[model samples]
Structure formats: structure tokens, C-alpha cells
Target chain A: MQKDSQKTKLRPGQLSRPKNLNLFTIRLPINALVSILHRATGCVLFLILPVILLLLQFSLSSAQHYETVIAILHSPFIKLMLLGLAWAFFHHFFAGIRHLAMDVHWMTTLMKARYTSKVVLVLGVLATLVLAVKIWM
Target chain B: MLIELLTKRYPGMRAWLTQRLSALVMAVYSVFAVARFLIVQPNSYEAWVDFFQPLWWRIATLLFWISLCIHAWLGIRDVFKDYVPNPSVRDVLDKLLVVSLWVYLVWATWLLLG
Candidate 1:
């Protein structure tokens, strides 16, 4: 049959289809960028769980320990690291909310999704900026 | 139809719903926590201790941690499934993830209630 011949021809074409895996060569759309960042930030937040717990325990143990924890957090390098982690949290928070909204049939269109993606990114940065000011000013 | 999707017949749907539900819990908690912190402004050791002293607050915190563990487990499992193609390696990673999440859950429970 003609359909059988077409199927036979398609097999070789599919097998020879070009594959690109180089990450740098592939430009991600805004939604994709937000989506991947959400996952990356989630991993970051999960990995830091132990550190957060340790710091909370240390800060709660005694007055002196609390002071020491405060001092450590206030150090310049640690403050920078904290700001980075805060950004991660903020990004994950906003992007996760956007995803939830989409799940409930809100902003399901491509253009609106892209707009929400930018909103999430900007809100994440804006939140970190506010926290930076709170920390340093 | 919704109940059927969440039943044992459709495990992927169950997992999807769990992830979303856990996310909702955590999101609400995060907002509440920030607002509470701003209002309390726990500036001293005593104040900080007091911030956590309330029994209800501690219970809420525990619930947040539980949601967090569930959320993390599902998220990391999906990450492993996507990136780790080798079945054996993925299995090991999956076990590791489960073990670590349990340890965290235990630690959090002890911290909050112990």
C-alpha cells in the first residue's frame, strides 16, 4: 500500500533527524527561563534547609549564642550570601504562584504566560532589593 | 471525575495534586510568617524565643515543615527522573532523597516540639 511505503520512508527520516544538545546554542523563551529558574531555586532552597535549621537552633539556644548568630549574619560576606539565598526564595515563591495560577486556568495563553514570567522575575528582584536595603541601610 | 483522577488508578495525578496542595500550604505559611515577623520585630534573644514560644505557632511551623518535606520530595524525585537516565543510578538517588527527607522531618519535629 502507499501508506506502508510512506511509513517506511518516514522511519529513515526520523532516525536521521538533527539533534542539538548544546545548551548555549539553544535560547530559552521567557516562560522556559522562569520555569527552569523555579526548579533551580527550589533545589537551592531545599539544599539550604539544614543550614536554616542549624542557624535557627543556634540562635535560639542562648542569649550569647543568639548574639553570635546575629554577628555572623551581619558579616559582609555572609550578608551577600544571604541576599543571594533570599533572591532564590523570592523567585521560587513568585514563580510557583504563577504556576499555580496557570494550573487553575488563569493566564493560560502564551502572551499572558510570558507577561507573568516577566512579572515573577521582576518581583523576585524587587523583593531582594528591598531586603538588601533592609540589611545594609 | 476529579475524585477518580486522584484515586489509586492515576498516581501521576495524585502526585501532581500533592505538589500543588503542598505548595499552597507553604505559600500561605510563608506570607503569614513574614507578616508575623514584621509585626513582632523580634530584636532580642528573649523576643525571638517569645516569637516561637506560642504552642499554636509551633504547630503551624511543624505543618509548614511537613508540607515542605512533601514538596521537596516530589520536586527532587522529578528532577532525578528527568536528569538521571540510568535506572540503577536513579534508584539510588531516589532512595537517598527519601532518606534525607525523613531525617529532615524528624529533625524539624524535634526542633519544634522537643
Candidate 2:
């Protein structure tokens, strides 16, 4: 985010390089990609958490509400949505830990940042996989 | 222009620290809740209700709710602060967000108690 302007700035003679500004076509650095995913996941979790809480509340409130909630949970579509929520939670959790590490002056170097970003992404996905199994299997 | 506005207006290091601390709280609570789920097999409605009936668990959950609201506010506000450059609009939006979070927390407390 800090060097966003620097990224768009064109250097003299550097115009010879591909000016591919398309996000889909151009290659992005792994760390940059991780950063984008982190933000995206955060946004999803931010929007989804209230719904999750409401569902939990329903599950606990009354016998009828609990039955209805459990029936909804048994649906495959709801299961899929639950998996998505779990992935969002895991991604946000791992990427948040990475941010905390960066705050501590570690993983600030280019090499370390890239390596850590990869680790965060992998761990996030792994945690989600475990959750998916727990829910689906 | 929107990006620039969004990229600015962060409440700085204090908010950053708060987010981190609240995240820690939530993560720890997740572990505790998951472990209880595994051990107790709280699959039934009565079981789930019983699980949440304890005073200590209720207190821990209340703590988690507080942390969650704070974490959510700091996280969401971080993004909003960056994009909403107009102080008046930002302030209104921020207050609304906080109020909603607080309202949820109160609702959660009632759910736990009632």
C-alpha cells in the first residue's frame, strides 16, 4: 500500500518493458498477492460474522429455533457456505499473525516477507481443509 | 482518489495494537471452545445450552464478545478511515458502526443470560 503510487509511476526508457496493467494477465509478486488475499478475506469475514452470530443465537434460543437451525446446517449448500466462512476465518487469522510478525520487525525483509507470506497462505488453506473435513466428513 | 482516501485516516499504532490484542483473545477463545466441543460432544440443543450455562464460560464468552467488537471496529474502521476522508462523514459512519457492534454485544449478553 505504501508504494502503490511508485508502482504506477513509469520510468523513462522503462516503457520498453511490457506496460501490461491488466491484473489478470500480469504476474504479481507472491507477497503482493498474499496482501490482496488478506484484505479480501478480511472483508468477507467482516461482513459474514454477524450472520454467523445470529445463527448461533438461533441455535441456542429455543427448541424449535434449534431444530430449524440444525436442519439448515444439514443442508449441503449451508455446509458449503460454512466451509467458505471457515476459510475466511482461517485466512484472516493467519494473515493477521503475519501482520503481527511484521509489526515486531521480523519478516520485514524482502526474502523473509515472501517466505512468510507463503507460509501464511499455506497454513491458512490447511486450517480450512481441516475445518472442511470436520464439517463435511 | 477513493483509494487515497482509504489509504489514509488510520488511527495509528494504538488501534494497531488493539486489533492484535483482540485477535489474540478471539484465537484463544476459539481453541477453548473447540476443545470443549471435542470433549463434551455438545451436539444436542440441551447440551449446547448447558455448555453455555456456566458462569465462568459465560464470563469468558462475554470477554470474547468485547474483544470481538473491538477487533471488528478497529479492522473495519481501518479500511473506512482510508477511504472516507471527509471527517464529518467518517465520524458519523464510525459512530454508527460502533453503535451496531455495541448493540450486538448487548444482544449476545442477553442471549447468554436469558
Candidate 3:
């Protein structure tokens, strides 16, 4: 009776504090990591929109400005930076499509989900690489 | 009957559908944009302007931006609703975010039309 009464009080156990922050040691499944990366890239795209829009605004504001902006994008360093942005965009995009498929009940199984995630990652990387080659070489 | 009842009674069902529909539009646009970019490689000023000049492309871009705005607002509102404890404060924060997103959307529209 006392034990049951104590449980009714709703006292939970003490909280444990984690000491290590290392990520590499934990081997997360590919699908889990891919879902995480989707959210991460979504945040990146969300946070960077102001800058992207500002650049677009400048480019559209005037022809002279457009030339200058295009010149800036022509630089190797800027191309590399844009390449990273492209990868984030591509990865987020493909992963988002996979999510939509799941929403529509297309591939809700664990194995199928993981397989689609692998496909998303592969397509994103390949597209990014092709864009990089076209821009740089 | 059950499906209709479920769709009508369930909370946040409309928002969930909105997110998916917007995602569909955005996904299609993303693929088309990538292929167009890869083929044309609009690194020059003239090519860049040319890319935006086509009426069909402009309409597609406009639709994509509209979808993006709707998608983002619903997602952000959901996050604020989940995380923020104070109802009034969350309402204010939500309004602020909505205003900011609208500002960007209007700016993009102007860039497209003007």
C-alpha cells in the first residue's frame, strides 16, 4: 500500500548528466542521420535566405549591379561557397521529397525509408558535383 | 464516412496537408531549376536576365515562392506553439515571424515584376 501510494505521488528518478559531447563514437543508422541532416539543411536554408534575397535584390536592381554581382560569383572562392550552398539546397530538396512520399503513405516501412534516404543522398551529391564541374571547369 | 469524419475532426489536418502540397510544388520547382541551371549556367549578367525574362519561368518562380512562404509560416508557427509556454507571448512572436516572411515574399514579388 505504501509503495503504491509513493508511486501515486509521481516522483521520478534523478536525472543523469551526460559528460561527453562526441558525435562520431555513436553509430546512428543512416536513415536516422539522414532525417537529422534534412532538418539541419532546412535550418541552414532558412537562416541564409536573407542574404540570398539581398544578393538577388542587388542583381535585379541595376544592370551595373548585375555585372558586379556576376563578377563576384565568377571568383573561385565564391563558386566554392555557392557550391556548398547548392549541396545544402539539393540535399534538403531530395530529402524533403522523400518526406512528402512518406506523408502520402508511399514508403513508410523502415527498410524502404532507409533505401530512399540512400537514394536521396546519392542524387543530391551527384547533382552538386555536376553543378560544381559545370561552374568551375 | 470515416475518412471524411477523420479529416474534418482531426486537429491540424489542414496545416499538414498545406505543408505537403506546398512541398510538392517546391520539389518540382527545385528539380526544374537545377536542370535549367545546369544546362544554361547563368554566370553572366545577360544570361541571368534572360533566365528571368521568360513569362512561363516567371510564373513558375512566383508560384514556387508563394508555396515557400506558406510552407515556412505554418512550420514556424507550429514550432512556436510547441516550444513557447506563454500563450500571449507566443502569439506576438508568431505575428513577428509572419511579418518578416511576408516582407521577403513581397520583396521577391517586386523583383519578379519590377
Candidate 4:
């Protein structure tokens, strides 16, 4: 009976990756959305950390070095990167709050969960834009 | 009462509720700090100094540092809690996290205010 029930291992191409991320039917749920954003933001921050460390090392070297760091920050491309960092920071921050709220059972209802997730993304984007404008101007 | 509050009202479910809550608070202040910096772009050293001179800004910056310290503490504490389950070892590590947070807060305050 056990031998008959045993399944054969599949050969290559027996299973393939999905063609696309289907957002309509069988939608990926809100919790999964938040989880993916959290992981992605974490990865982005990890990549950005070395630049921050470099700034720290240079800033501590001397007043002239500090000025050079400030000048680099003032560059257009670097400004854009910082803008991305700002948004990433805020996006991760709000999503973290959403996670906390879920943990505390404040927004655990299905409707509330989905609605709050949307709100978090909207507010995060709004915040990033506002801060970027402020920094860039 | 405190234990009940943490167990029931804490943001995190299994552990690190305090840390998660601290991070949430820090996020709020961070948005404000960025906004404030944008309000006054302070191109010169004197201008930057003047920006920090406002009593309200000083208080807000103080709170911001406090929040950042708490958030860092929570993250580090969670690491210890997850990896070091031995009660005695965990307790020691937890105390160290708390201490480091205070130390960071003090250093930040000194730099910003003193």
C-alpha cells in the first residue's frame, strides 16, 4: 500500500516557474504583500549601509573631509540616491508599524488589514515625496 | 500591571513588542525631522546652528534621538532573545542592550544639545 502511494520524483522541466505574478485571480494576500515589502526594503538598506559607513568615516576624519562629504551629498545623482533612501526608510518604517498593529490585534480584521496596508503604502509614498522635495530644494 | 500591558498591548506577538513599538514611534519622528530639515535648508553653518537653536526643535530632536535609541535597543535585544535562550545569558544581554541605548541617547544628546 505504501509503495503504491509513493510518488515518483519529477524530471527537469516537470515544474516551471509561474509565467507572471497574477494580481487578479487568486490574488496574493495583504499579509504576504507586507512581508515581501519588509524583506525587499531590508535588502535595499543592507546595500546602502556601506555608503553610510563611508560617510561616517570621512566626516570624522577632518573638517575638510566633512565638507567633501557634504559636497558629495549635494551632487544631483547622490541627491537622488538619498531620496530613494528616504523613501525606503519611510516605507520600511510604516510597514513595520503595520506589522506591530497586526501583532497587537488592532487591525487584524480582513477589511482593516487590507485597508491599512493600502494606507501605509500611500502615506509612505506621500512622505517620501514631501521629504525629497524638501531635501532637493 | 506593566507585565499585563506588555503582554496584551504590545505590538509584537511572540517577542520584541517593545522593540516594534519603539520602531513605530521612531518612524513618526523621523518623518517630522525630514520635514523640519526641508522647512529650513540651512546652507551655512550659522543657519544650521540657528535651526537647532529653536526650543521646539531642540525638544523634538531630543525625542528623536530617544526614539532611535529605543528602536536600536529593541532590534539588538530581539537578536539576543532569539539566539540566547538561556535565562541567565539572555538576562545579561538584555541589560547590556538597555545600557547601550542609554549610552547612545546620552552621546546623541551631548552632540546635539551640549
Per lDDT, the best of the predicted structures is 1
Estimate how well candidate 2 is docked, as a DockQ score: 0.49
- Docking quality tier of model 3: medium
lDDT of 2 by residue, A1-137 (tens): 33543686756444434456777887889998888787778778767767867988988889899999999989999899888878887877788888878887987999999999889889988988898888877
TM-score of each: 0.94, 0.81, 0.80, 0.60
Instruction: Write model 3 residue lDDT over A2-83, tens digit each, in one string.
Output: 5754756644563333557788788989898788787767767776778888898889767899988878989989999898
The residue pairs in collision within model 2 are B5-B82, B5-B83, B6-B82, B6-B83
Question: Which docking class does model 4 fall in?
Answer: incorrect
Look at candidate 4 and give me any clashing residue pairs.
Answer: none
lDDT of 1: 0.95
Q: Is candidate 1 or candidate 4 better by DockQ?
A: 1
Clashing pairs in 1: none
Q: Which 10-residue span in candidate 2 chain B carries the lowest summed lDDT?
A: B2-11
Worst 10 residues of 1 chain A by lDDT: A10-19
Candidate ranking under lDDT, highest first, comes to 1, 3, 2, 4
B1-114 in candidate 4: lDDT tens per residue? 657756756656524655665666667777687778778877664565576678777777677667666656555565566679899989987886677557666765765566
Task: Please give the TM-score that candidate 4 achieves against the real structure.
Answer: 0.60
lDDT of 3 by residue, B26-87 (tens): 98897799789879887667788898899889889989998988988887776677689999
What's the DockQ for every one of the candidates? 0.85, 0.49, 0.56, 0.15
lDDT of candidate 4 over A18-61, digit per residue (tens): 45657576676866777677656754664454465456446645
The numbered model that scores best in DockQ is 1
TM-score per candidate for chain A alone: 0.89, 0.80, 0.82, 0.76
